[model samples]
Target: MFGWHVPAPDQAMLISGGKSRGEAGLPFRIVTGHGAFVVPVMRRVTYLTLSLMESVIEEACVTQQGIGLAVKGVIAFKVGSDQASIAAAAQRFLADQDRMSVLTGQIFAGHLRSIVGSMTVEDIIRERQKLAEQVLEASKLEMANLGLVVDSLQIQSIDDRGSGYINSLAAPHQAAIQQAAKIAQAQADQAAAEAQQASAQKQSEFARATAVKQAEYQSEIDQAQATAQQSGPLAEAKAQQAVLEEQAKVAAKNAELREAELVAEVVKPAQAEAERIRLLAQADADRTKLSAQASAAEGRIALDQAIIAQLPQMMQAAADGLANANLTILNGTDGLNDAVAQLAAQGSTILQTVMQGLAAHHDVGQQGGAGDRTDPPALGPGPDDDAAR
Candidate 1:
């Protein structure tokens, strides 16, 4: 209705309890003044008031530092209590719920996205004091543009979940380094054990070879000693046998020399002496036989002479004896004949005795005389003495 009538700057309207002056692009107010004529028109004054509990759901932007954030929390603003600005805000912005509630929410959302997009989470967490002031300043301009005067601005909290995501990416590389170190240590231990085993095997082989060589050398020495021990006695026995054979040959030579000297010196002389002795014995035996015969004849002649003389005597006596016998026979014929036969036998016996005595005496003298017969002389070749005869 006020748009239809024009009021001069000097015009007065009733408000509160008195008349007040007028201005364009401002809310009308009632006023009191001195006597002036009233004019009638097709315009009237209207009044509006708001309760204390009414709130405008609008956004306010805040930039936080050190607590760097990409999402924001709740922000709140209220209209001021100043009457002049209140009247102006109510007239321009309070006409409908769409501009005050919906349109204001959209504008605040844009401001918050714009400010937070360029910041990090660390910037918001470290800069809390600076962030509260920035929210108040930005809310003042936004509220005025919506024909509202800001009474108070506040910042609640900033959200931070982006910081934890960055630290998770680097964990896998650290685990791989620890695994590689353990594998290298195991390989070094295995190499050391193999080297020790090889050294032990080589030492054992050398010791075994040395022991075998020593044993072979000892065996050869023992064989040589045994050969020397056996050979010495065999050589000594052969030398003794040779000496005995040579002694036997020398004794045989001595016996042959003794036999040859006997034949030359003694045997020939003994045989010649034996032959001369035999010749001398034959000559002596012949001489002795001739001498014996001559002596025997002489002794026989002497005995015959004596016998003849005795025979003459014997004949005479015999005659005388025979005559005596005949005379007796005449006395006794038988006695006489016996006496004659006895006398004839006695005569014949005496004659035979005389002849045998002569032969015996001849033999006695040829041998030797009766005195020489006791020991006869050696008859054969009386030494060499008969050689002269």
Candidate 2:
């Protein structure tokens, strides 16, 4: 605990006044990352920081054009990791180590002014990164003398000292930027307006198309409705027509049946009846003709018998006439003549009587129907019959 010394990762322990050659042949022995033991009061130990350090440089500089400017920059430096660099850093800044930033800032400020004096305002502003790189490069050698290494240098700012040189240089670029911004804004506005107008036109066309489609649908619906409305009556009319047709057919069939009935009930019977009456009339006509022929024959027979019955009467009349009249015959001829005349008279009388009797019988027959006609009576006895008895 008394002589044991340890250094932090970022620290270097410098042990002086009785040390071995700890490399680089320095008067002190440096310990880092481990411990070293020493004799009591004989070795003096000092710790130097090996961590990074930052220094700010602010300097008044002149450009190559002789324009005066104020320049500000930062320098980042650290003690080197080697023993010789650590020993060198310890000899210079180990008593008051925070003064490392002050010395490094002073050194970087002088170098920054000198570098700015070699360049113009345009190079300092436009090539600020290159300026910082060059300045860091230049300080690499100089910082290595103090056992330090520069990690980076940044130019914080440069002022024109109110000379208006930087403003004059940048005026044209600022105005061009403003003009470009305005042009971009105008193009964007035009594009937005065109898009809005196109949207409005599309909406209008959609509305019109919707209206047309609705109208077409409505028309179709109306036509369908009309057809539906008429269907009831049309169906009824058709039904009634069908009914009427059926009725007519039935009526026509009834008429045909009635005609057949008339033929069966009336025409057939009427024809049969007419034929019966005609047959009876024909039979009666034939019977009446036969009766008339029989009656005529009976009349002729009665006339013949009546003529024979009247012959004797007519001869008596003739004999009377002979007695009353004169008749002569010479010799026997006179007698013969009388007798012959008498016979001739007798024959003529008989003929005349036959004709008269026949006429009388015909008259009687004509007065009665054949059913009422009587046969002639048998022959009656006459005066001649009495003479014969």
Candidate 3:
């Protein structure tokens, strides 16, 4: 009494004495002549209805890792698009539902394995509906060739329990970056504060050094003024001492000049009078020399006058003797007169006869022949001769 859930072929049987053969053996007729004879009887009747719905059902006892997926789906199929393939696939694939269902489940499982490896947990959960549609479209071509169809696919839930571990591991790295940023900002602020303090200290030291220099300059000015006041009276006394020395030198020079003028007036005239007396003594010596020359000229004139008085008498006596000796002394004037007197008086009387004879022989020219006659020898002196002698 179990009614078959799948449909089967229909047939009828008729029994008389023997069975029909050939075309008559078939219970159904191609022509409409035997239709009434194959009708079902009341007690022996049977008809089976096989489903034409294209969904293939499969049951799996899978022990997989717990990915938490719950899904239900339906795929529609027909015998292939050609009639020849329809008959072949209907005979081969329709003979058992378990083999066809196992093949279709393997196709769906392959799509799920690829999606799981490539997609993250969040992507799979958020896009579950789109994931089912993509799997259904990919499985349709192979399933349809075996007279199977995919109608609709459904994804009830997708869950990722590993997301908690991913978020927990990232927290420490984020905190480390924030801590480093804060430490860098603190170092920058500290350096700026140190630089400002150093600048202020330098300005303060410069102001103190300038104040010390100004105080020293004022002290030096005060010392210079005090020294000038103490030395003023000493400089004035030295100038007065120089003026007194110049006045003493001028007074001594004036006394020397007055003494020299008195000597020139008194001594020069006395020297001129003494020179005049010496010239008068020289004139008296010249007058005595002229008086001696005049006395000597008078003595020479008297000697000459005495010699002139005796010259004529001596000349007369020389003439008389020359005449008596027959030698004529032709003395001028007085000698001639005395010689003539002697010849005239004595020569006439005493020698006249001898003179005449001498004259007569001379006149007869016999005197030239006359012999060298010697005068008679001197007779004795007469009284007159002796007396004249």
Best by TM-score: 2
lDDT of 3 by residue, 23-81 (tens): 43433222111222332232122221123344433322111333433333455433333
Which pairs of residues clash in candidate 2, taking residues 3 or more apart in a chain or in different chains?
Answer: 329-334
- By the lDDT metric, which is better: model 1 or model 3? 1
Q: Following a full C-alpha superposition, what root-mean-square deviation does model 1 have from the true structure?
A: 42.6
> What TM-score against the true fold does each predicted structure earn?
0.28, 0.55, 0.25
Top of the candidates by lDDT: 2
Q: Model 2: which ten-residue window has the lowest total lDDT?
A: 380-389
199-302, model 1: which lDDT tens digit per residue? 77777777787788778778777877776677668657767767777776776776677666665666665666667777777776666677567556655565
For model 2, the local distance difference test gives 0.82
Native-structure RMSD, model 3: 39.6
lDDT per residue (tens digit) for residues 155-240 in model 2: 98999999999988888777787788888888888888888888888899889999999999999999889988898899899999
Q: Which of the predicted structures, 1 or 2, would earn the higher lDDT when compared with the native?
A: 2
Better of 1 and 2 by TM-score: 2
